[model samples]
Target: MNAKTRRLVAASLVAVTATAVLAGCGSADRGGSGAQGGVLKLWTHNAGNAAEYDVVEKVVNDFNASQTTYKVEIEAFPQGAYNDAVVASSSSKKLPCILDVDGPNVPNWAWGGYLAPLELKGGEVPLDDQLPSTVGKYRDEVYAFGFYDVALTMFARKSVLDEHGIRVPTPDRPWTRAEFSAALADLKAGGKFEYPLEMGTGGSGEWWPYAYSPQLQSFGGDLVDRSSYKTAEGALNGPTARDWAKWFRSLVTDGYMAQKSGSSPNDDFLNGKSAIEWDGSWDAAKNVEKLGDDLLILPPVDFGQGPKIGGASWQWAMSSNCAQPEGARAFLEFTRKTAYFLEFAKATGTIPATDAAAAKIPGYEPGGRYEPLVRAARDFAVVRPVTPAYPYIASVFEKTAKDIVAGADPDAALDEAVKQIDANLKLNDFYAD
Candidate 1:
């Protein structure tokens, strides 16, 4: 809650309750500490991530050198502390003109008046070429856009799968619910590894929902019903959701995985301690580098519903109270260049935001080794529930899922999750504010 994570339970409460304390959102002359009118300040949460920080620095340097109307100064903070800093700045009315936000938090920030809807003129950004999940939209209004997105997939060794007689899965024909279970069973029975799967069950905060909820969605359930965004109700406790929870728990009960995996699931997979490791694309390159052609980056499983991977990452947006709103928009527009996207994708080893940019990246180009990942991102990605209350809901779902996986009754766990979510929605007046 003290940190700036969108799935932070405490931060979610702050996001909803602290709106009154936030300075009013409008075109005000109260700007940042940068030089007067001609200077616009930009903030980033990449202080610890050298690769992404360098990419942000390169973009700002080029943008500043390319223009005279606005000089965008940078203030980079460590990711762990960045979100909290934004919240504190917003309350004191000292937010920078431009800032990057976690995609899931855009609705909360926008609805709370901390962010303004983006106003990119026609063709300013290649919105069409960008992956749908990279654009952060809330209530039908564009709020933020990222230069890249990360996809989730399973990492396996071809040798292990072949030894276990597990069929390799593709995006078009992913492992069904039964097939995936059988594969895990085969791996477990082979006795080559203590556990057949490693899914980073040790992860916390946002990772829980970002990694697990998509499986729930694939089972024809979600953290909440997107149609209303008001409550969990049938979405969390319904029959499909119950089935998903049972399967989720069965992974541990059936000896397919650890209730809490090792701190480094990727390393476990790389060491052959686990036959399959369900993880995000951010870890794919290192695994690929180590295993080379033996590494298998497989798509998510199809659980009655189509296969899915959670989408959306960090994205840029203008603060609602920016003083030089026009300058802010100008810098925002400048960031749309495909070249920046290419640089970002290269710098971070991530999937490019646009296909044009992806074509420029070495491994992500057409028919390249990483090409299936890009296709998987396009075909299977699903953004989390788009609502101001999403942060709260995500937190609740994380706890509920953990409880169920630890052997709590699925029905009781889901019912508790639904009750908590509905109570929060009612407390916030359904986030109508």
Candidate 2:
């Protein structure tokens, strides 16, 4: 779809889905489950991803086999359509007993009463060992748990950086802002590659905020002030944020990176068109296969505050209207096995949610290759703001960031964003409980 179409659809979804989740919830019958001692339905967004789907399917099948009193069923949708499907299901009160949602949206969903606090029976899956990003929480209660998470990191060929005299950075000592700029400048001046950096800029939707807002945070600005989660105000439109905007645009205008990277930044980097690529752990396996020992999965640049990256991917939750909350919780707890975490991490090329799961995977073991990504996630990862206003905030940030990257005045764009965000928060009474 074109940019305009995508924006329109996203906005419409935000409105329609928000209404569906808030209005007339708890009015649906059965929520697609048995009234008592009956089958429990589970929905997932992994139908299009066979590996993850298989892992989910196995978990469901195993749960069904393990208990005679309750049998869990699976219905899957493509990731792109899953949210819309849930919204429609919710409007009709056909939501499954359990459903998986994006981690960042858990707060919104829970706040809208679409999800219930995950009460795992028998403590089947202890959450203490899992990464903080894998446990989705709001109002001091966990609403969702995820299998794995992806870390945002920089990638380059060790040989190329070595030849360029660029020092490979570590989690403890990442490239400072000046050093990163100098490295990019050197790569651009070398002229071996036209775009010294490929940042997957052609992507849209959550990618814009999820991939870039952390850079803004590293510059000592956040999507919103976490202290109250009330307004963007000085947070998004502040001086540090403006610096982030100007520096980001400079990456494109100064010719260090593509304004719109090719459809695949990883491919561009692999093909030698880009010296360095900023991407997720999902793409690291491919680069490793191609570059072998020369592949460098380096830490993000420390833009003053510290290196930061977005966290929280997809997570599973129990529907608030589930007819059998106990059964739903049991099913959710069943899926949190260490084996499943390992399977998911291996299949999806993401970091394991728990250290035990990480130990099971090669290169994910401590002090091994790719462990820096795990460290980055554990150290520098920041979950998006926890509030019902987040979806709107994310959309605003996306638009403002895009405009700024396209040469719009950062201050003006950011001020407009803050105005809209404040208006929204006030409209919702600060999403009061």
Per-residue alpha-carbon lDDT of candidate 1 for residues 8-42, written as tens digits (9 for 90 to 100): 33344434343342342222224573337688878
* Candidate 1 Cα outliers beyond 4 Å, as residue runs: 1-30, 33-35, 122-124
Question: Which parts of model 2 have CA positions greater than 4 angstroms off?
Answer: 1-31
Model 2, 1-433: lDDT tens digits are 3333323333343545444333333333343654646788788888779988888888888888888888887777767667766765554456788889899888877776677898675544588788999999999898998989999999999889988999999888999999999999999889898989888888898999999999999999989988998889999989999899899999989998777778867888898989889999988888889999989999999999999999999998988778888888777777778888988898888999998889879999998888988898899899999887788899898888888878898889999999999998876667776
Candidates' C-alpha lDDT: 0.83, 0.83
Q: lDDT (0-100) at residue 39 of candidate 1? A: 81
Return the TM-score for candidate 2, rounded to 2 decimals: 0.93
Q: Go through the candidates in order and give the C-alpha RMSD of each one to the true structure.
A: 4.4, 5.0
Give the least accurate 10-residue stretch of model 1, judged by summed lDDT.
Answer: 20-29
Clashing pairs in 1: none
What TM-score does each of the candidates earn?
0.93, 0.93
**lDDT at position 201, candidate 2:** 84
How much is the lDDT of residue 65 in candidate 2? 88
Task: Tell how far residue 73 is off in model 1, in angstroms.
Answer: 0.6
